[model samples]
Target: MSHVSSICLRNSAFSLLVSVFILMLTACGDLRESKVDGYGLPVVQIEMNSETLGLLLGQVTSKRPVAAEVKMQGDVKMKCEVSFAGQSSLNDYRKSLNLRACKNHPSEQTRFRLAAQNRDKTTNRAILAYEMFARTGMTVPTTELVSAYVNHDFLGVYLLTEPISSEYFHRRGIRVADIYQSKFGNAGFRKEFSSNLSEAFDYEGDGKDNYAALQGVYKTLWDNLSDEEFERRIEMQIDVDNFMSYMATAVYTAHWDGFDNNYFMALDKTKRKLIVAPWDLDRVWEKAFEFNPADFLSRNQLLFRMMTISSFRKVFASKLDLLLENFPVEVQLSNLEMKKAHSQSALAMDKVNGPDLEASFDGFEEQIKVWNEKIRTFRNTIAE
Candidate 1:
């Protein structure tokens, strides 16, 4: 009986040791799976719901399915909820989806790190544009950075956005054939460029007129000219001048920033008309001023480059003329607030981590120079 008991004890001891060995290996395997770079930091994954994004931005774009994803490199993660609006067949995707305004609108995602990585001066310009667009009561999405994180991982920043069209449609109402006629002219007749400005505003001058800026800008254009056939000259200049401003801005953008993307078109829910949405704005004039003269002058020299500049100038020149003429004198005043904005952004960027932050706007001086030249031309062309 004593011998049998001794053998049972030895067998039990062997089984316990084996169990301990298996447990040790299993724990090590788990540690390996969780470890990244052997730092023992668990990897984290984060995502943004298109449905939630659609909700926050609902104020800008119509209810349509839109989406985006969030990722992290270091300790920071960001999720930007952006708004969307669409145009008919702007690209292959549009053609494939046959997208329209009320349906799926084409839009994009944004990261605040971009603003942080670039020169503060350049960054603030975009913020100003977005602010002005909103102030002008056209349409614009909210621009903001969001914060989140998981465990030890830091999710740094993202954007909270809405469509620009939401405000545009609310104010502009619907597209009138007459408004198109005034801005684009009759494709059918193509006889001469004629604009129906009066139709755009309240017929009784309650304020909003389709032909809103006509008389004011007409006078300005006339005054600036040599009075050598003022009406005809003013008319001719207005046709292409506004678009030149857009061209100048675009060229500056190409020279200044290395980025992917450009402007967008939207549907005005109120007027059911197509309109332009501000987009891919990371490229801007201030940055362009930092470019070398040779490359800078001929920046954005691509297949559609000329088209981009030409179309913008053509469309807005007429409006600029009319606006100058009709715009209230008090509203013509300017402000130095841009200086403050630039200073503030610089301070913020100084707080950002990763790669030498001061060098963020390395090529900025050149891009700024090029952009200023364009501005000079723009100012010179302004109707007296």
Candidate 2:
């Protein structure tokens, strides 16, 4: 298991022990009420039957189907199945959730993700990243801020997001022949692993062997081919523009966890080329960006190899410049400031349930300033 997963498992055990202690305290006639209140964001009230709620709580590691009614701002009501979501967020006191099969929703949107945003105290990184991608003309999931609650108990502010799927492409007037979500930690395109490549990609499309063409591309790219031939063939299969935009976004945001597994690939039928869809963006901008630009991309060998080519390297560098031009530090700070204003009040109430209630938001603000400086320094270094 991964290091984070191990920590999560240990945390889960500790949480269970804490729960037992709380029960004991209650039994001794000493009880404390939870002090969580809804944030100013639109409230997502989920009403689950007692049996279904118990079932959901019981299946902490696995997803259990629990019937629930979800209402947003007292307007949109959905009858859906609720399941705990995410790798580490499942272990959180306020767990992230996945809602599926909401009434009257499009088939592609049968599911929605409510991210816990635990890492980002600002709780705007994912939303900011998604908006940045859209501003750059990339197809990405739409996100909204919502205050989620279960059975009258306020959970906290969550980012309600649409999932990347074939239906997502259809809605955007793009036809996807195939889609694959890269497996975590196994980002390389190794032909020797072709037999099980399908398992790694997590094939999301209809066809049985849609990964066959992708495997062939991987073999041709690595095994034997002139640079010219390889570039021509690879360009035919993968959209270079899309790839550049994705890499630029990752670098600009200093997303350490982005490249390898936190992305999806779709075959756009019109272009007959692969397009990248970014995912799991909450960890971006965790610190000042000062590492070698190459360090950001060392994990994914395909992109690493492409960078060795002068022409591809030039395109990648140009994309980075364009990203810096388009998303300046001032613009990003303004966006962050707006989001902070909208969420700070909610976060204040929400933090009462977590350990960071005493922490100042000034630290987060300082980090943002550090990020802006890092971006400028990195961009200048790259230019030189």
TM-scores, one per candidate: 0.36, 0.84
Separately for all candidates shown, the number of backbone clashes (residues 3 or more apart, or on different chains) is 46, 0
lDDT of 2 by residue, 235-255 (tens): 888888888788877877777
- Per-residue CA lDDT of model 1 for 1-384, tens digit only, reads 344334434543222212222333333222122322212222222333323422422332242433433333344344433232222212111011101222122222222221221223223345434543333333444554322221222322222233333333334454322122121211111112125333222221223433323333434332434434443433442333322333333442342332112333332334333343444343454444345323432332221232234344344444434333433222222221333333333234322322343343434434444454554455345332
Residue 350 lDDT (model 2): 67
Q: Model 2 TM-score?
A: 0.84
lDDT (Cα) of model 2 = 0.69
Model 1 has an lDDT value of: 0.32
Candidate 1 off by > 4 Å: 1-125, 132-137, 148-152, 163-261, 269-272, 286-353, 361-366, 381-384
Model 2 lDDT, residue 371, Cα: 70
